[model samples]
Target: MAQLEQFTTPLDAVVSRMRALGAALPERDGVAVFNRVYLAVTEEVGRQLDAGRFPDPGAAITLDVRFAERYLSAVDAAAGGSRPPACWRPLFQFRRHPGVRPLQFALAGINAHIGHDLALAVVDACRSLGCEPAELEDEFDRVGDLLTTLEERIREDLMPGPDLLQIADPITHLLGAWSLERARDATWAAARALWALRRLPELAEEFTERLDAAVGLAGRMMLTPLPG
Candidate 1:
């Protein structure tokens, strides 16, 4: 009960922050759109944690909080007019552009979160827990699965009605180029690689930078402005 309380306190705080952002920003604003989607996912994860869905409750809590902090940190950086990590720059930079669709904003946020944040979060959890990447694998997989399913729903809900959507649309093609499953897989690989290089701080930093830049490139592509 104490452990749950400890985790719930911080998790609840994060959710409250997201909720405030959702309420304050315009519905069509790209960051607001993505914030709503992410807040839903975060709330669901919190419920699962409370219901004892995770095998290692402590590890799960650690990873969940660490993962969320990365996103929240990006939000803080953007709000302060400071540069966030490369992986997150695109979403904030193009967030208000009328040409970018809501679905694009949601997916771009997921890309930055899963592709870059998750990998680093795994490392953070490992360091904090004094365990290993293997110890957190189950928690990672469970979280990834949730995000994977949510990605589908985000597409379905945000997609334009049949009259507005067509096979020839550029947004369709751009979205087709990215896959949450592939991104999750690559992130797992990156997590493992970072863990392996944990002893070499310099090498790990370089690897992380490359991963961030590559993911940012994908995000930039995903956010490509389209004709309204």
Candidate 2:
């Protein structure tokens, strides 16, 4: 009970920071677009936690907080004029480009968070919980499931109207190639692989770096400019 109490403050702080970001950025700004989406999801997670939806509330909170911190840290880094992780560079770099649509911004942010930060966040949660990735599977699945639902809503809310969009739209093809479900699956694999290589610090570092770079490349592709 006391351990769980320890996480509550941090979780509240994270959500508060996200809310502030959502309030501060321009609604149409790429990072703000993603921030609004993420903020809604975070608030939902908080509600679920309050409703006792997670079997392991402590583990769930720990995972959720750690996962969010990674994204927030990247935001902080960029704000501080320091380099964020490679996976986050594209969205930050292209955030204000006139040609990138709101949908691209949202998905690119998701790609960086889920594809790169998530695997690392899982490991962070494990270390904090004194458990392995397997133990966190239930929490991970619940969060991932929530995100899958978010993905659907993002598409519904941000995507162009059907009348205005068609099979040949470049944005359609660009966003079509990336899937939140696939990213979740890969992140799980990466988390397990990272856990396995925990003893080999050098190798683990290299693996993480490569994963960061690969996810960043994908994010860059997703952010490819298109005519508005």
Candidate 3:
């Protein structure tokens, strides 16, 4: 394959990051870490969107939305007392960072974009399902409004900042504001988490095995109702 381009435009930035990650990962692993490399490349997609850098978007954008969906699942799992049940098709993996630190800003960035796409995805699906044309157009506009705000926030956050919002979300702030320290920390924390989650599908085989075991047990239990 051709070497990943050194990105100049914001659109290129996402692609370059993905290429960088593709190099970092081991070749033996399966689907689990596949998307992981992509996150490293696309970490800046939000920043680009915020800057009106969306250019020639394609399947990659939808794929990124899938990346966000995994974390939405993670957030849900976190809110509940259990990890969401693993599936071969579920596209993310758990990552154990070396230290406990706030990576919420990066998560916020990915989540923001994911949400932006999810709104669009709903409408896209509606259109695919033959929903009314005018209603679909309205939803498109609504989704556009949301994406506009999300992109703006991402851009603002990335700029250099002593601002409160940037401080509040250090991970994403650099898209608008450049901070060596925040970028470094994000490299370790936010960047790593996002990368790991993206490649989560690679862990599918192991997860599927574990899931099968759980299902087997559940099946046996179901064969005999609880005895008081």
Candidate 4:
């Protein structure tokens, strides 16, 4: 417990610094932050790879899907007739950090496994709505599929041989492949949903339900918090 606490202070400080840095970050800087976060998360996941101590990536993806739904409800309430905010551009901007390319190898692999699981959750969520979830489902589903593709495309590089991560992440290669506009639309939809939920409690019930589910999943993932 004492040792765990030691890591907390440093990580919190790093995250605080990252946020402070974020204030001055240009569009590219946001991508840098994402890359850094991805690296850190990937490293942590890699450590867990040996023992599989981490929660399933698919589960994490599912949690995010629920977050999106909650955000949608909230956004709808917040804006009313006003146009929804643009969130996808910022997110895409965040996804392609330059200096942080070192972590791409790990992200591609871990994200691949989780991406499919997350996509399934999205499809299920859409089905529950009684109408086709064209925008939301398509947008998020693309990310999962892309991650899966990234996994396969980069598998060899990530494995033994030479390291390709230092040069560029597979995602970076997709640049010029996609117009920033596509991501911008999705980002706006997601942000609007989040902003809306914060302002409207009644409509934000989904957020609470999903949060509860996340906690429950955590508990279920491990019978207890202690190490095996």
Task: Output the worst ten-in-a-row residue range by lDDT, candidate 4.
Answer: 219-228
Candidate with the larger TM-score of 1 and 4: 1
**Pairs with backbone N, CA or C atoms under 3 Å apart (clashes), candidate 2:** none
Off by over 4 Å in 4: 1-132, 160-228
What does candidate 1's lDDT look like per residue over 176-204, in tens digits? 98999899899999999999999999999
- Root-mean-square deviation of every model: 3.6, 3.9, 20.4, 18.9
Candidate 3 matches the true fold with a TM-score of 0.26
Question: Cα RMSD for candidate 3?
Answer: 20.4
Candidate number of the best TM-score: 2
In order, what lDDT does every prediction score? 0.90, 0.91, 0.37, 0.36
Ranking by lDDT: 2, 1, 3, 4
Full-model lDDT, candidate 2: 0.91
Q: After superposition, which runs of candidate 1 have C-alpha atoms over 4 Å from their true positions? A: 1-7, 163-165
Q: Using TM-score, rank the candidates from best to worst.
A: 2, 1, 3, 4
The digit string of per-residue lDDT tens for model 3 on 54-160 reads 54233325434544454345435744656543321122222222221112233323332332223334334333454432333333333344444544554454334
